[model samples]
Target: MTTRTLPMTEPATGLPDRITIYEVGPRDGLQNEKSVVPVEVKAEFVRRLVDAGLQTIELTSFVPAAWVPQLGDAEELLDLLGPVAAGQARPVLVPNERGLDRALDKGVKAIAVFGSATETFARKNLNRSVAESLAMFEPVVRGALDAGAWVRGYVSMCFGDPWEGPVPVEQVVDVCARLMDLGCDQLSIGDTIGVGTPGHVSRLLEALEGAGIGADQVGVHFHDTYGQALSNTMTALAHGVRVVDASTGGLGGCPYAKSATGNLATEDLVWALDGLGIEHGADLDALVETSVWMAQQLGRPSPSRVVKALAGA
Candidate 1:
């Protein structure tokens, strides 16, 4: 793969010129939580996320209710989004054609497809081999494209897996290449177990570049288990990647990777970006407040280090 170390981002600058915060509070953030967030609350939370100026929100997953009862309200939640705001994009997660059909039935204009980078993960997590899962999604992607929907491909455990040691850079890039070739508008690479360091992140992105995926077509999904999400984010930004995945209050942990935490907090990402002059329109105070409200609704304190620090509770 084509890999290169990128120049560092100057700490003095504020947030970047424009940043797209893909809010996963509903799907990725909620799927792994022990307590169930009421359907109405989830819907209101989604509306709140949009009201908070988040332009792209990953709403919910169309996975079977039997698999993820927490997201059983996907259809109801999608209905509550009302309509796409002037410039916002609402994307939902789909596991296959059945899931995509459910999402499309709700008229979702953008959708995300989930896959794994490792064969073991693919088999254990999705009940299929890596190639088998990708092949299954072929018709789904083609159908979504034909329906004029923007499709995003997700490669989970891009860096490491709980069952596996350090994931090879080549494996990550290869899966990414397959997804990108399937007419996916974007590919989100996830650090499922949060075991990556800034240097590892740099190397991975460099590999994607070598694999012919442009920085703009790539998105980063990080968990804060190692407390290095922000630093690795810096590495991602330096390589010209534009999108990031964060959840409100750091809502859910990685289900497969035992003891793993949830995604990086939106507040932390926005804080770091704000300090970099990156110009993300996310309201840190409001986002933190949203986290506080959701945490209270969930009858717990937020897991986000940034949210906890800001709440001063």
Candidate 2:
């Protein structure tokens, strides 16, 4: 059966005319899986995403197998992807210098470094204080930039932390500025625990702008734990953010933050953007089909509302 079409466009004012949906289903979405996905399946998944018109898909991370065994086939997966990985903005997450080296050796042209907005998370996730983590990332970011590759810096737990509740906006801004100073081309602010509200999202974006980090160079990554991911994304778009990070079937959460849930689903995001009359070059039917297939592979129904509704699952 053919999938359904999206809602008719109703353009929203004060939002960017076009939006870039940075697809993370292949990397962030599958990272926390209990069982590893076959590299061949991962290659097909990426190929399907590219065919679905997602121009920027994060392929995988170069972290050690002991860290995230789910993505241990990173090199093999890339080798399988071959030219498919070359045609689009395929960014990989690199935890440190060694991760960066592996990605570079694989001819990766885009890389992202993950950072924490709270000290507790920094220690828990990176085993280092915030200062120490940033220091370590400095050279990694510089090296990627020198190699003429694009670098993205992710600031996690931007709104609230599991250990340290209600993170101050200024604290997030400081970390964001530091990441940018380290030569990151873009920064993706993450509500890692999904405890953020629209007001909180606005305050954080405004504070970042005040700190000289404009929405043009920023992206928003939200989780659906609190059922606020879509609303928070709308708030960011209203503030002029053009890049959004989403997983294909609402497929990922932070392993470090137990409270975190699945990410903002790409099908859900596309549905909202279509309703808002924004230009995001994704094929809704294609995305829903991909999510449905992936959900079958994972032995569960897709959590994406749009995918379920459209696929009639």
Candidate 3:
């Protein structure tokens, strides 16, 4: 006997008809692992994500091995994946001009630069002041754009910083604007410590709009430390944002921010989108299976509630 199931679609009035899930499992998800995940396993993870119908997958970062040893095989992994076909957006994280040079040499067409909204996080994560980090990114973003690669700017700690406590909406807006000015095609606002509520999310979006940065040009990346990731995501969707950053099986955390937890799980987000009647092109069953396999690789069960429930079912 076989059982069939489908979520009841109740479309929300103010949300976008379809939103792009910017899948970050390969890069952001595995970056904090203590043990090195082999290049072949990482390649298969990317393949599984593609098979699960994720349109925009962040493949890996080009930071030095000393910085992020988990993704040291960026070039080898890209080689395994071969040429990115037309219509597929596979973005790699480039920390500076040197990383950008390496990615461009590999014929990378999409790249992202990670930034911070607060001075403390900037110093801790990048070992530079916020201004200095932006200065470093200016040339990198320019070089990527000049090379015809699509660039995304990621502003971490948009909601709250462990060292700084609550981050002001105005501060986040300012950093986002600076990143936009750096020629980034899009900006991903990150709730690095998972401390944002729905109200905070709304106010931040409003402030960003006041600064001339509309939701159309932004995506939301939420961690689940406080279990508000889905609620915060709903708030963003209602505010006209159409892109969301999520990890498979809730796999990642910020290494610099020890208080931070796993990212907003892709499975949970997809389930929420399914119920909301929002169009996110992902196969729920395939995603669940992929997360289960990945969890096995990491020697633990998935932290995603949706993945657990579905996998058990």
Candidate 4:
């Protein structure tokens, strides 16, 4: 319910002076954890994120409980967040029509469908080829749009895949275009294995731009496995990307990539934005507190450098 924007002009480098940091801690962060976090805890996690001025939170996923048992309490968590009525946008990840149905039944106002840019990743994650998986999502995307829900499309392994190395930028651009043409209101390009560098990020965005896909419709998701997430994010910003996906406490990894590390920490992103004179509207101290609280819940130290430094660990 708080105003998330500040008045600023677009810079000479084409970056928006203000950016929207899409918080994905509750969903992507916790889904990969081995422990089954309590539903009440997940509810509170989202509540605290809202309190920290994260207006857009990826709350949960509607995947099969058999696959991701940690998020089995999706409905209960949503119910708990309902009473706040804070008008923060809570978007859930739905893998297929069945998952979309579960989300729509719960009155989900926005949903995201995930796809991969490479065949190997698609097979490993969704048990289907890239083409076939996108085929499956067509109907799911149509259904969500028909139900008057906002749709976001996620293309994983945009830069590198675990099984297949260094994906071609042209292939990534083609797949992203397909998602956009399939009616996704926005497309989140993911560096699933955390292997992207600033040059790679710049090339991908330039490819997308060459293909007539504007940065306005694209968001970037990066992991800090190689410690390049923030640097790559800065590259994206210089190219006009305004939305970036980050997880609180640096939690989350690709379940398919065993060596992959946690996501780009929200605290680290806030720190960078603060120093750059950019506006993201997040409270860094509050976010660090949330990370500390979550690290305790997970029974591990947070992977974020900022969190560790601020926590004086």
Please give the CA lDDT of all the candidate structures: 0.84, 0.93, 0.93, 0.89
lDDT of 4 by residue, 131-230 (tens): 9998999999999999999999999999898788989999999999988889999999999889999999999999999988899988999999899999
- How would you encode candidate 2's per-residue C-alpha lDDT over 1-313 as one tens digit per residue? 9655658888878988899999989998998888999888899999999999999999999999988899998899988888544457999999999999999999999999999999999999899999999999999999999999999999999999999999999888999999899999999999999999999999999999999999999999999998999999999999999999999999999889989989999999999998988899999989999999999899999999998898876
Q: Could you tell me how far off, in angstroms, the CA of residue 285 lies in candidate 1 after the best superposition?
A: 1.4
lDDT of 4: 0.89
TM-score for all models, in order of appearance = 0.94, 0.97, 0.98, 0.94
Q: TM-score of predicted model 2? A: 0.97
Candidate 1 or 4, higher lDDT?
A: 4
lDDT of 3 by residue, 131-205 (tens): 999999999999999999999999999999998898888888899998899889999999999999999999999
* After superposition, candidate 2 runs with Cα above 4 Å error: 1-5, 84-87
Prediction-by-prediction clash tally: 15, 0, 0, 0
lDDT of 1 by residue, 243-310 (tens): 98889788767556675787888988887776666777787778888998888888889888778777
Name every residue pair that clashes in candidate 4.
none
C-alpha RMSD (angstroms) for model 2: 1.5
The Cα RMSD in angstroms, rounded to one decimal, for candidate 4 relative to the true structure is 4.3
* Most TM-score-accurate candidate: 3
Off by over 4 Å in 1: 1-16
Q: List runs of model 3 lying over 4 Å from the truth.
A: 2-5
